[model samples]
Target: MGIFDWKHWVVILIVVVLVFGTKKLKGLGSDIGESIKGFRKAMNDEEKPAEATTPPAATPLNQPTTIDAQAQKVEEPARKD
Candidate 1:
């Protein structure tokens, strides 16, 4: 028989269920199902184009501003021992 025969898989499945118990395995299966559903939803959403929306007008008092800055790394001079 091949390594991945149905009988071998069944034994492995039985051992896994015995080790982890059915309740935890059930919860794990549901969690996996939910994550997979969420992943598919995200993929479908990504495939759809986003609607263009205009930003609200900003008043001087409530307008947000950004500060631009640049950083440079300084190298220390090596001293001769």
Candidate 2:
């Protein structure tokens, strides 16, 4: 029989469901669907040119900025033989 036969697929499906319970199977199905959706989204994204993407909002030049740093001096304990 050909691999695409309905009987073979039914048997395979039965075996899979038996090995993995219905709840687990449902989660697996959803996970697989999400993965496929993500893959398709990524593929579609690749078709768009980078230049077409929106640029980040510009920060105002007059905004105040902070540059802070702290320096702590520590002395090591004297070694004892």
Residues 15-66 of candidate 1 have per-residue lDDT tens digits of: 9999999999999999999999999999987887655445588669877888
lDDT of 1 at 60: 93
What's the TM-score of every candidate structure? 0.62, 0.56
- List per-candidate RMSD values in Å: 6.4, 4.2
lDDT (C-alpha, whole model) for all candidates: 0.92, 0.94
Best by TM-score: 1
Residue pairs of candidate 2 with colliding backbone atoms: none
* Candidate 1 lDDT score at position 29: 98
Per-residue lDDT tens digits for candidate 2, residues 1-81, read 786799988999999999998999999999999999999999999999989988888888999888899989999999999
- Angstrom error of the Cα, residue 1, model 1: value is 2.4
Window of ten residues with lowest summed lDDT in model 2:
1-10
RMSD to native, candidate 1: 6.4
